[model samples]
Target: MAKPERHPRKTIPAASGPTNSAEEAKDGKDAGYNAGMAVFSYIIGGIIVWSLIGWGLDYLWGTRWIVLLGALLGAAGGFYLSHMHGLTRQGSSSGGSAADRGPSQDGAQ
Candidate 1:
């Protein structure tokens, strides 16, 4: 005699309303934004510090261009460093591009 085939059973959770999920998703987005902003602020602060150092150097050497160059270099370095740090924290890339893992609530993929 042939044996009967058994079927796999699936289970679904009982939940109502979309509010809970929406709120949770929004919180996640907010957290990411806040983290990114914090990193950006730190970068700006670093740039300011560099500018101050450049100013001091200028004053000591009696040369304005040298100080200006230092300030510019510092700003560039700060921006690069901050961008990398921010991306790393967010678990993303510095390319500013996002890949869709699947459909989101907003129909974004």
Candidate 2:
């Protein structure tokens, strides 16, 4: 009987690294959680600090409603801070404007 012909084996490329999708997802989740916590902390901290100041003012001036004003101001300041931070973040990430990007997909400029 004739000898069987031999073929060279194919070589598979090695993976770059052992990266896991679950780990990536977890990291994304953690980052989101951290951001949310930071915003919450900012708001809460603003409220607490301003409320204390207001309370002190109320005591010093013998008024009753300054604490409420302080709380409102704190809330507004917190929202403004968060909005600014969000704008900054968007600017950094987007790196472009609507004009730079093309027109709307719906044909509305």
Candidate 3:
């Protein structure tokens, strides 16, 4: 048996499409791409730095457990930093773009 094609339940009319939606979507896509790259870099960088530190400490102290601990700590710190510095900021910026700002009070002057 052949299957039928599926389509979206709702449709937007071409004549009434949002003015800046396309631009906003593109901006969002770019922002998301950048954020993903930054977050990945952060995680990898954190892991490598902390693991190195842990390895150094183990070497100096002749212990075998610190490297795993360091990696965990690094992962946590990376997530925290990425969230604080990138993801949250990106969300706020995307939500409050120039188009959404309407107008400024100084514009009347």
* lDDT of every predicted structure (CA atoms): 0.71, 0.81, 0.83
- For residues 1-109, could you state the per-residue lDDT of candidate 2 as single tens digits? 9999999999999978539988877886787777777778778888999999999999999999999999988888887787777722443345588778777799665
- What ranges in model 2 sit over 4 Å off? 1-18, 87-109
Q: Global CA lDDT of candidate 1, please? A: 0.71
Best TM-score among the predictions, by candidate number: 2
lDDT of 1 by residue, 8-106 (tens): 998898886456788887887898888777666766776677888888988998878766676677767867776776543435543333445444569
Considering only N, C-alpha and C atoms within 3 Å, which residue pairs clash in candidate 2?
A: none
Summing lDDT over every window of 10 consecutive residues in candidate 1, give the lowest-scoring window.
Answer: 88-97
lDDT ranking from best candidate downward: 3, 2, 1
Q: Worst lDDT window (10 residues) for model 3?
A: 86-95
CA lDDT, candidate 2, residue 16: 81
